[model samples]
Target: MVLNYPDGRLYSDDIPKKPAKQVRTTPPSKRTAQTQKKNNFANRGMRFEEAINESNAYYLSRNLAVIHKKPTPIQIVKVDYPRRSAAVIKEAYFKEASTTDYNGVYKGYYVDFEAKETKNKTSFPLKNFHQHQITHMNACRNQGGITFVLLWFSQLQRCFFMDSKTLDRHWQAQATAKKSIPLQVIEAESTEIFLGIAPRIPYLDALDHYIALKEQEHDN
Candidate 1:
């Protein structure tokens, strides 16, 4: 005669016992602790995206620059209608960004740039950038557009405005042993942006300095 339990499983003496999950008592490594500390620090202040949005609003209100963040495109694959007020999205996939994050006209010149943050204290890795972004920046520069990247070192709490040309040169040389741009190189080549009370990130001042340098280069 066969016997069955309440769960509809056959009651047998041969059933094996499941092993318990193992827990580690060792402390996290130095690198892991440092990364966790950086994450905590980031959580304390306003997010990078929020700060940029506020700065953009400030610029627009002052009639300085009309910049806007590009919305990411998404392909909706599945949807469910369970007799609710609205249809819920079940599954979706993100499409690749066509261009830089922020783009608009600033002082008769097209401005295009991408914003990125890194926790690395020594250098910014080239892997953060993509081929399509580089190609878009190249196209903008060819057309006399002001293209740059706002790089934030989260661990250092420092920000820099790097021109696309310099960025492109460094990106092209990533095949060598140096797969990242050193902080010293960025400090020397790029313009440092300071946080302000009103705009949060006063990037327009850096843009002005870059434009002045470009005008001087043209005059010489």
Candidate 2:
């Protein structure tokens, strides 16, 4: 008896048993996963870090500001040198940050600040900040720098430019029952930053408003 398989194979039972389809056995690569995440971010909107960077670039190109993101300090414990030109960092740990995320000169004024994003809808958690950062901001303030924080409420798609001194005041009160800064307080004290197409964050505009308000307060 002879039989013809559905595939192009002629068979007695199956000529040789048609070879099984080769299925992909390889796992998805880490790079591929990272690329997917980046694509998702782009589709939704630029992430806080990316937005700030674009804004900083815009400022620099126009000679409006000279701000740059601070590179995190890393202590390398091990390095593999396959070649002098290629040294792979095998083991590394981040050192504690001594200052904020960004610092530079803006319109002849020293500008120093940290940028943070939160997923909370109503209040910003106190844990996102550190005592050392507060101290660093205080030191910068003492040096007559314009020190503040660029706070992003991701859930609400809202951004605020909060002065470091005001942040420190609330931070100190965290030892009491209050665990977070309410949205109302932030709205009252901080300058809201409307997202822009060119600069993205447009934080400098809020900074200008803050400066004017402070100057007015001083006058009063």
Candidate 3:
């Protein structure tokens, strides 16, 4: 299953398994895949946040839901005056973000989620999650929000939309016995999302599918 960190970031293969050490030396200002481009939402490249942002855009355009990426909270520590009219941010550090990556309302249901990618073909590492994220997710769920994770298995090129209930159970296990959730377990608990060009991950529809299934079960 696609597991969520307490903070609500989704874990998938496509997200870097380990956080990259900020390349302190700023490289040339050429835009990477993270920036917005002029193409249609579907044409965006393989970057994780970009795909998710585009997916959110697709949902917004279609009137499916109103979701947005959480802004990275950074603290500016220093600046350089290049000219009277221009000042470059010379030094900055990010503040600890308090919420998950994305949240909004869909069909009168509150939605909160995180996105993650992984390189490991076998299993996702537990290190991707932190304690603060867990607390945030618990709050969201308790408030009746539909919370989940979007996992991209980058190497396998597979995606999964996993519910938060399954994730909370396993994440809690770390305190007692298991330190990491096994790959075999993830495969069993998660619904695999088929990746495509349009809407990229197309995960919200999967969310709709999930909600429908739950409703059917309730009817039965």
Candidate 4:
């Protein structure tokens, strides 16, 4: 199967698969449970996007906010009908560049943000972002919407909420400065978000803090 972007660039989804490990068919044991516990703890910071989605679901259930991940628009070009009820898409092309990862309304303020994860220990690569996304965020901000990004440092198990304006400044400076955002700069400018149980990525707390700071600036 083959997929392509609107600009005719090849999009490869062919990830190398790891060899399957031998499975042991056995009944439940105390050691198995302990191993499971250790595995759960090890995966505490895995699947950053899933954590954000679960957090959104938690917020929605409690009537705290209405946020959702934006689905990528893809145009199907080829399909294989293996059975009458099982049609498989074999090829597709992206309709266009996507704006952001998530957007919604929180407390009457329009909230728009992108979620990104990086494995780097010291900095986040700017190549993770695109020009279209930056332009869209700026447009939303200009219209009085709260625009930001949720950055997950997977290696450090840390997350930060950075305003789009701050991101834009760094993005534009890439011509002269380093092609990445340093950890020190992010720590200084962004609000840290601590992970939780129900809402894994407790991002709204950071949002509230950002709103308070904006209000203070307005009053001053």
Best by lDDT: 4
Q: How does model 4 score by TM-score?
A: 0.77
* TM-scores of all predicted structures: 0.75, 0.77, 0.73, 0.77
lDDT of 1 by residue, 64-120 (tens): 999997775556779998794699988864455668878998999899998877789
lDDT of 3 at 156: 81
- Worst window of 10 by summed lDDT in candidate 2: 10-19
In terms of lDDT, model 3 sits at 0.70
Candidate 2 overall lDDT versus native: 0.77
lDDT of 4 by residue, 70-163 (tens): 7756678899998658888888655554578689999999999987777799998998788888999999999999999999898899999999
Q: What stretches of model 2 exceed 4 Å from their correct place?
A: 1-46
Candidates 1 and 4, the one with greater lDDT: 4
Against the hidden true structure, what lDDT does model 1 obtain?
0.78
Ranking by lDDT: 4, 1, 2, 3
Candidate 2's displacement at residue 140, Å, is: 0.5
Clash pairs, candidate 1, are none
